[model samples]
Target chain A: MFYAWPFATLLGRVLQPSSVVDTLTSPGIGRVIWFTCWQALVSTALTMAIGFAPAYVVARYRFRGRRAALAIITVPFMLPTVVVGAAFLALLPERWHGTAAAVVVAHVFFNVAVVVRLVGAMWAVLPTDLTAVARTLGASPARVLRHVVLPLLRPALYAAASVVFIFTFTSFGAVKLLGGPSHPTIEVEIARRATQLGDIDAAAVLSIAQLIVLAVVVWWSARWQRRSEHTFAAGRTTRRPRTRSERRVVAVVMATTVAAMVAPIAMMVARSFRTSSGWSLTPWRTLGANEVRPGISLGVDPLGSLAVSLRYAALATAISIVFGGLAALTIASARRHGRLLDTGLLLPLGTSAVTIGLGMLITFDTAPFDWRSAWWLPPIGHALVAIPFVVRSLLPTLRSISADQRLAAVTLGASPLRAWWEVEVRRLPGPLLSAAGFAAAISLGEFGATTFLTRSGRDSMPIAIDRLLGRAGAVPHAQAFALATMLFVLTAAVVAIADRQEVVDARRA
Target chain B: MLDVRDVSLSFGGPPVLQRAALQVPTGDVVALLGPSGAGKSSLLRVIAGLLVPDSGSVWLDGSDVTHVPPHQRRIGLMFQNEQLFPHLDVAANIGFGLRMQRTDRATIASTVEELLAVVGLHGFGPRRVTHLSGGEAKRVALARALAPRPAVLLLDEPLTGLDRELHDRLALDLAGILRATATTAVLVTHDHDEAATIADRTVVLGADMT
Candidate 1:
């Protein structure tokens, strides 16, 4: 209901067939669509290149520092795109700030985690014996990789690439902040047309096009993900690097990964601390009492923005848990229609956040149900967007548990409820906690949906940072950096707890 | 007495068990012997109330429990895979059923310790089930199944996966433990020697037997 009706209400404007033709024929429209696709394609390729070695290492070889490397890669992916754009805005050459290269670079930085986590999950359980068997049959190492490894990895690779493409395709906050006017994405264009130009006709057409593109990508990726889903063994052994050269390779790969992933974050934090005059904590100190006009009045401060974000994150997490948990259980229990139910529940995942926000604006404000101005609307949007991810992540773990486990508990004299608690819920602490972290973190960093819903004086951190950057002064820009750092720290802390819980789970095993 | 009568079940395919029947008096161990497709495990499942037969009545002591859920049946089962709870240590794993009964902490702890001793793993209480070796894991599973002191225990393929020496030793130890506790139980296995080692009466399940 959060997705389909509201989205359909907005897209139903497409009944004006003239608008579809006129919008497509409109000047600069083709450029927006072209930029969206091409940049996403390029960003997906770069992310794969940067993420492959780390994904492979995390999958095949076990080590102490790989956890740290994984953490570094993962944190960026969960970060809000606006903050990523802010980080590069702080780190890159000033001239590159509004260039196409800036958007691509930030996209790569933001999405390396997706490629790593998706591809790594599949690789960890991939049977190594097949490659060894090929070698025993006299296939060369390169040949083994080409024939045995790549073929096995294809499903995972396709799944990861398509996901990265969708994220980069729906690029909103980053493209808005970094893409500038010249390198506009369809999302930025829709935001501009609807909010700035009052061009709902054009915006509706663009939303339809984006929805079609995303539907195809989501469908394609789901197929590959299904093909890749066979790998969750009860447990599989991934060996620590044993030989001298192998150990060295692991060390080198880890060090480089950590350095590369951590640099932009370090730069952002350092920029937050320093100034034209010298290093100081003035920006942080002034965060609770800052103004857009510098000395005129106090305005969008980091403390208020942090509180706003935390509240939203907390609300979103709670909402997603109830809705997403029930959805997963419902899907898991459906004997014959589980796949169909899962696809239907995951409907919101196929639409970009901006589309949801825009749809809400279109659908909820007028006529029959005019509750668009409700305070719960934005958090609800975040929850709807997050629910699909929570369901997807929970289902595999839920399904991996055999019916025998629950029956084992039951025949041990546990009540059916007690059996479920003992076998199903107890085993799910890791996946559940991680999914919660994703919900909270995704809400904390969510910009596209929140941006459209932004109101002055109560701006979220992402909104505050975006507005602060639009101002022309050291203090405003410094405050933007300060808030971005706080956003990063908040997001990272949440994910760290979830990440460590995963390791703790393995330790128990 | 634990009695199964006219127990028939199929999982959407060829019949796994057809009108199978068995009876075990209190404190008597029965070993079910069958060929691979003769439904020895399926029969164990039916008796334990994990599976409801298409047509059957299960009697515990006197009353028919054909439609009773597994937990209400007061029956215990040690799975073929030794489905030990991976999250729990050896002690907690053994005490899970007692905890479900809302047994007091001290009694649960004492019972867990006693069962650990009975299984010949005196200090294994704190060790995670996942950390235990194969033979140790089997002992833990047995200890766990027996901890609740069910009216009857159903063990499926107790020593099937162990090496020959381990299998022989475990079978002997298993028989000793069953007799020591006077535990009423049904064990399913294909090996006739294992049946001879463990059961007072061996029941062969096949087309020729009921």
Candidate 2:
């Protein structure tokens, strides 16, 4: 409803049924979709291969520094795409740039965390009974995993694959930085046509096409989720003890995962602190220096942008928790499965943030609906991006509260609201706090669509870093590195807090 | 004090309890006995107002309370596991019902202490529920349920998971507590020995009830 007008009108004009049919038949569109499918498929497969062994180790064994290793593996998932791209750029040799191979490598780097976290968590909860039964049937470990474990893990694996596919399909920053002209995502094309060439019609048509593709993928994934005929007994899985060979395998996998995940970040940090002569603190010192270029300053300060980013992130987190928490509770309480409502809440996740920004820009930048000047647009944009995560984090915990407990409370003379508060709300603090922290981190690091939505002079940390990278100067580049380092530290802090809450919840359970 | 007349209930596929009727006078503990999947728990659920039977009437104190919501029925249910709120300490768990009823702080505190004494859990009020032993937790669960002075109490396999000695001791303790409160009670169990130990009258469930 918010973006109905411009989308309708623009669709009416540019996506004349005739042109859409033509674009559908065009070889370019097919090529683009084919490339997207191939990239996402390979990326998902590679992520699984690289992530599975380490995830299995973490799920099964108890060893020194295991918790720290898990935390390190998760850091890439929390970092913004642009920062990940920047880290890769800093690490890669100049000669090894602007190739499809580089883009694929970057996609794998960005998505391995998704596979590890989702699959590893699922593995942790697998019931020991299944494995015991298989062993009694005289099955080896390899045979059990192939026949029993993998079949049981289908839902999580499919979910992770769909998420990775959507992310890579709409990937903007990494491809833009690594592949340049050689590889352009539909997202990049939409941005180029809309902002650089002033072709709203073309941009609108492309955005609609992207939306259609995303809808189909999401719908397919949802169907797959419903059709997958596997449900494991809850709260029954136990960890296994590692043998010598198993221990060696676990050590090797952990070392590779950590090294792969951390090398780029290490390079980024090293770059943040280095100068031409040697290691120096010049970049950090110059982070706050305000040198105005000719006729460019519109009262925008770097420090002010930092404040704005924090303010917007805080607001977005609050909004996400309230709305997302309510939605989760409603879903949990519904007597029947709410497929439509669930899909509606999750649709924004697959739709590119830049596309959403464009949709908002087109709808709200003019007429009686004008809200471009309200200073609320950015936070609204950030909230849209964060709500899906909030729902994801809250749903599992909400669903885990047994129905019998709620009934027990009610039969004990508690009102409906009181019963819910005692039985449901009491268990929600950990997930809610963690969701809020994730939302704040997302808002802080958001760049792609934020670049399109904000005013020309106003900037967030990511946009500031992008500007510094674009300009041809030593100081600006150094400042960009410093700002990137600061953003990384901030994101790492937020994720650490969220992970701590998760640990606390695990202990309680 | 409580009467259930010709109750029939189904969960979409098949009826779990059909045309089942039972009665319990005040201060009587009626044990509902059945094997697994014989709808013993479902009967208890219906009595506690957690499930709405297809055709039935529940009378408490000569008033029809069939349509009353579970919260308004003044019934208490204790599961095999204690199901104590993990986030709350023993005192808060005991006072949970009073807090829900919006009772004053002084009354809540006094009732919690009184109930703790009855359960022989003095000075355990501030301890986390997670830290309690199996027997101690069951005692606390009983105290919490009885703190609100419910008109009826329901227990579902309360001794199913315990060893023989602990189970017998807890069963004896629970029966004594129920007698002292003069609360009409229903106890569901698969073990005939447990039912005989705790109940004043025993009713055996059959496939016809399901």
Q: Which DockQ-derived CAPRI band holds candidate 1?
A: incorrect
Model 2 CA RMSD to the hidden true structure, in angstroms: 21.0
Cα lDDT tens digits, model 2, B1-210, are 889888888755688887888888988999988788878878877777666788888888899888776666777877666566544689987887776666899999999999999888999999988788888988998887787778888888887777889989988888888888887888988888888888998988874432
Clash count in backbone of candidate 1? 2
A108-132: candidate 2 lDDT, tens digit per residue? 8888878888887888777654443
Best by TM-score: 1
What Cα-based lDDT does every candidate model obtain?
Answer: 0.82, 0.77
In model 2, where do residues sit more than 4 Å from their true spots? A1-15, A18-34, A122-152, A225-228, A231-242, A292-302, A332-337, A397-428, B1-210
In order, the candidates keep a fraction of the true contacts of 0.00, 0.00
- Per-residue CA lDDT of model 1 for A1-509, tens digit only, reads 87778778887888788999999999999888888889999999999998898888888898886766787778788788888999999889899989999999999888888878988887787665434323322235565566556766777899889989988999899999998889889999998998889888788889889989899888878887676543212336478774577788788877887777788888888888776678888777788885544478645666788888888889999999889988898888785799999878766887788888888778777767776667677788899889998998789878888889889889999999999888888877788898899899889888888866766666788988998888777777888899999888888888888777767876876
Please provide TM-scores computed only on chain A for all of the candidate models, following their numbering.
Answer: 0.89, 0.86
Provide the lDDT at A401 for model 2. 82
Q: What is the interface RMSD of each candidate, in Å?
A: 20.3, 19.3
lDDT agreement of model 1 with the native: 0.82
